[model samples]
Target: MSPLLAADEPSNLPDLEILRAEVGSAWSAYQDTKYTRATRLIPGILADAQRAVRSYEGDAQLQAKALLAMAYQGAAMVLTKIGEADLAWMAADRGLGAAQESGDRVVTGSLFRSVAHCLLSNGRLTAARDLVTDSAGYLEDGLPDASPTYVSVYGTLFLVGAVAAARLDDRATVRAFLAEADAAAQRLGQDANHMWTAFGPTNAAIHRISAAMELGDVQVAADQGPRVDSSTLPLERRVRHTLEVARAYSAQNRTDEALALVLDAEELAPEQVRYHFISRHLVTAWVRQQKGKPSHQLAGVAQRLRIVG
Candidate 1:
């Protein structure tokens, strides 16, 4: 149960071969701004993956729970990144439920870390902090210190810490946690081929850019994000990365570039990909609003934003 697979619902009930193909194609399409095609297939994939866990007949509680928890975590990521707060939280809750059922402390730690992430994405920073602290206790409970999974859990905890600090406008704390996350992630470099790290590098960097922007360092984020290659990222990735870039531009008073990037992203992605819609739209609107103030205002705009899980 790779946690990465939990992000999107594939649209069909294909076998492993077919499902993998579907996810691969979807990832490619998503990166290329083919949301109309991508969204059409994601939900089913997610549903099928979630359903598969129900049939896990394994005797090992740790393995089963870890697998199931990853499923929920994946689902939560897809929903939250796409701005579907309700569904994202539900998915997180479901992951927590699975972890509780298996009683695997390590998986339980993962669950708390993930659910806290979902909450942080939904603007529940205090709740996220408490949960991350709770996860720390689970991490301390005989968990192997050197497992990639353990390192990943600590990375998640630092991410939550970064978000909490971001919410409070605590620049020092934000940098500290974010740096810790990067370092934990780097520690896993020994297993760069580890499946856990395939997307970890890109994903963690994205969050780092987010936290950097939150800490009022768009210049640093802009300089840093070039490494993410937005054009080469999938639909969800590009949409998000584009927004971050736009924010960086806006922060630097590069209004023309910011507005242009906003429009470009809007034109590239579809409304059905609400993950791209609401998340990027707010940033676009804010940037446009900022540009228009004190002399001129952004004009000819109508926004359609849907709040979902």
Candidate 2:
């Protein structure tokens, strides 16, 4: 944990604003790409914080802590989404540490929420539940009334809880969590619109469709999935949506249709080899195996998908 204050004394809030601006710039560079150049910006971000900590111009303690807390949360998310569990856990631990030092209830609540989410991604349901439960007081204490970040924290709580329940096969609990997530998603609406591709209606729709599928509500998935407007989706995200539809087709036992769509997705974005399309191939391969035609083209696709994974 780093110091929140500097040797110099604060004279005005303008310097605080500049620090915030610098932080945004750093984050933007980090988001545009993750290659070597993008990775190189991290030191500048940390150094900027160090400079702010030493520059006496505002509520340095709160400012420094807040910036660190945000950084930790953002880094954790990047780690989680790309299937990098080790780095995500480390970043989350750092976030928790920073939040504790900063003593910002909202930030603390957000940190715990993030930790709970990473646990959910790793399929550690019990751990996720405990952390979110522990975080409730901080969430309620801060009363995430008008803050978009606060609303997002609760959204993650509900969504991750639903995922946990799904893992445990707790249909009733899963339904409950989905309800809560839908409510939270509604609360997040336009208030929490960030340029990042992480949260928003698209995410909420994915969850809604996935939940509907697990619940054996295919019509719901069909109806809800189409509402995710392509106009609102970025190219990479649009590819994800295609995969979801393919999954929906599989759940409906439409193997041929699923294969056609999966082929289209693979064609549209070949770099997405690590995603769930491998499982799709395995499923179709099994279908062929059952049909006593393991040598078929469908079976070949399954083998290729496994190799891709």
Candidate 3:
């Protein structure tokens, strides 16, 4: 057995509730861009979860396995953002397996969401879209009367699929998926972090901005930019939305605004923004667009983010 997953290793398995709480805390840290802390917390949680699933039975095992899946999802997300797609894929695959074992469809779909994201990060756009499309369809049944939680889960799936489609430049599929997700968001009537999916009208709108940017509709994205309420989202997502807006502004030759938005994202989540692909691209563009020497702050940001020498 791999040392990391060895059932006999010195283990400090928390109770199932504590395990769940820890995973939740890890997710919160992840959202706040405290990636160092979150990443450090994942391996031990994963170990305990694996042991629990192997050693326990009944609901306890199911719950433990579910928590393990969440841990894998979080780890995969961070790994992917850091450009470690192979490692991320392993975590995502493990997560999907654990989710299926738990018999929670929403949880399973959420894992699929992470898997699709990892695939996209690895440049497997077609695979990512196909996976998310199939997963979303798997959740389509009984939607009319589904609980708010289920709807949000499916909405999150649809949004992920939309992103994949957008990356592929498949405008038709992108719009279709976004519309479905937006409808789910409208039904919710407000923002919610249900099951940590963070699906709601505001989140759907944020996705729209991203989609617009992906489609190279700088004007449309800029027009919709002001409508997003950053306060309604978790810090990580808020930073992402801000960066997407920065991209739109960059595309429109609004260099000053784009630079400001990139700086804003850095201020909101320094670690996340510094490591993000969008931030890298924007910083490069911002530097190239400057007519003269850049500001000290901008130079420092670019140097620290390694986008400039």
Question: Which stretches in model 3 have alpha-carbon errors above 4 Å?
Answer: 1-13, 142-144, 289-292
Report how far off residue 111 is in candidate 2 (Å). 2.3
TM-score list, all predictions: 0.66, 0.68, 0.94
Q: Considering every candidate listed, which one attains the maximal TM-score? A: 3
| 168-209 per-residue lDDT for model 2 (tens digits) | 666777777667656766777742334232455566666667
lDDT string, candidate 3, 1-309, tens digits: 122765443364457888888888878888888888887888877776787788777988888888889889988888877777899999999999999999888788889899989888888989988997888788888576888888888888878878889989999999899999989899888899887788898889899888888888889999888678868778888888888888888888887888888888888788898789999987887777678999897798889898763
How should the candidates be ordered by lDDT, best one leading? 3, 1, 2
As for candidate 3, its clashing pairs are: none
Which model scores highest in lDDT?
A: 3
| Residue 275 error, candidate 2, Å | 5.4
How far does residue 233 in candidate 2 sit from its true spot (Å)? 5.6
Candidate 1, superposed: residue stretches over 4 Å from native: 1-66, 103-107, 140-145, 190-205, 222-239, 263-274, 277-309
TM-score of 3: 0.94
What would the TM-score be for candidate 2 when compared with the true structure?
Answer: 0.68
> In model 1, how large is the Cα lDDT of residue 243?
75
Candidate 1 residue 208 C-alpha distance from true site, Å = 3.3
